[model samples]
Target: MIEHATHQKIALITGANKGIGRAAAEQLAALGMTVLIGARDPRRGEEAAAALRAAGGNAHQVTLDVTDQATARAAAQQIDERFGHLDVLINNAGITGSGQVSPEDAHDQVPSSVNLDMVRAVFETNVFGVIAVTNAMLPLLRRSPAPRIVNVSSAAGSLTIASDPDGPLTGLPTSAAYTPSKTALNALTVQYANELRKNGFLVNAADPGYVDTEINNHSGYLTVAQGAAALVRLATLGADGPTGGFFSEDGPVPW
Candidate 1:
C-alpha cells in the first residue's frame, strides 16, 4: 500500500503507462501532485510510477483497465481506502481501432465497408470506459473541495470540424469507429458536466491535438508534451474555470 502526504493533491490518469497519458502524469507530478498511474498492465504501471519517483515525483501505480468494470471498481476502492479523496481524474485511456492513421490503413474504416464489431470495440474503450471509470470515481472526487475531471478527447470528435470543408478533419480518411467514439465521448462530457456542475465538480473535454503517439502510429506532428498541455490545463483548472466545453491547445474547439 503506497501512501502520500495527506495535503498533496491526488490525481489518477488512465492509460498512463505510455504516450500522451504518461506525459500528462509526469507534468502533473512535477506540479507536486501525487499522481496515480493507472494502466491495464501492473508491471508497466509500476515501472511508470518508478520512473516518476526517480524523477523526484510522488507517484504510485494502480492496476486499471478502463474497459473492465471489475478493474475500475477495484481501482476506485483502492484509491478510496488509501487517499480518502481524489482531486483530479484524467480519463486518457483510448484506442484508434485501425492502430494506424495512414490513408491505406484507414481505408477499411469507411462508412460502407467498416465493421460494426470494430466500432463496438472502439466505443468499449473510448466511450463506455469513460462512463465506467467516472462513475466509479465520482464518490472519491466529490470529497475534494475542487474536483476536476478531464476527458481526453480528439479534434475528430467535433461534429462542426468534421463537417467544415476548411477544417483539418474534413478531408481525412478516418474511420467511423474511432472518430464517432470520440464524438460520443465529447457528448458524454457535456452531460456529465451538466449533471455535476452544481456539485462543484468541473468536467470538461480536452482535445490533445495531433500527437505522435502509439494510437496514431507516430503520424502526428505534435509531441506528447504538446498534446498533453490542454489536458493538464483542464485537469488543474481553478474553482472559477469553465466546464462543459471542448478545448484544444490553441483554445476552444467547435462542438
Candidate 2:
C-alpha cells in the first residue's frame, strides 16, 4: 500500500459541493492530497474548496456534471492539461426515486400511474452518469502510479439483502429508481475493475449506510461524515488494497 499522496495524488470527487462527497473531499484534502471539488454548481464548488482550504486542506474546484458528457470530457481535458494526470476519482453523485414504492405495490408505479420521467432522471444521475464520468476520466486516471476509483453507493443496492426472505432491507423494500441504479453501479464496478486491474487501477463500490443528508431528506440516522468513512478508505487505499468489491462501514457487504 502506497497511499502517501506526497507524490501529488490528485483526487476528484463528483457531487462534492455537499454531503458525504464533501466530507470525503475534506478528509482527503486534509491528508495532503490535492482535492478537486467537482460539482455542477461552480459557486458551490468554489465555496466548498474555500472552506476546505480555510481548514488547512489543499483544495480546488471543477465544474462537473456527471450526467453531462460534454462537461465530463472537458473536465478530464482540464485535469490532464493542468495536473498531467489524476490519481483518484470518486463517483459520489447520485439521486433517489420518489417515495418508496414496493415491488408488490407496482400498481402505484404503473407505466401510466407513476412518473416515468422521474425514474429516468434518477437513473441519469445515479447509474449512467457514473459510467459516463469514469469512462471520460480514465485516460487521466491511467497515467497515475496508483489509481483508485470509489463509487459512493448505498446498501439499498444490495439485491442479496433487499431480496432475502428475512432481511433488514425489507423495511426499504420498494423502488421506482435509485436502488436499481446502485445495483447497476455495483455491477459496473466489477467490469471496470476487471479491465483496469491489469492497468494497476483499483475500482470498487462502497455503501455509505443510510447517512443523514439532503439525498435522504435528512431522515437517516448517520451523519454525512460517518457515511463518508468507507468512501474515504476506498479512495485512499494503498496499492495492495481490495478492488472490484463492495464494502460498508462494518466491513465487506454481500452482493
Candidate 1, residues 109-193: lDDT per residue as tens digits? 8878787777787899999999999999999999898999999999899999898888787668966888899999999999999
lDDT tens digits by residue: candidate 2, 70-188: 99999998887778788999999886655433454333433445667667777888888998999998988888899999998777788998788688876553765667778888999
Clashing pairs in 2: none
Model 2 Cα shift for residue 76 (angstroms): 1.0
Model 1, CA-based lDDT: 0.91
Q: What TM-score does candidate 1 reach?
A: 0.94
Error of 2 at 216 (Å): 1.2
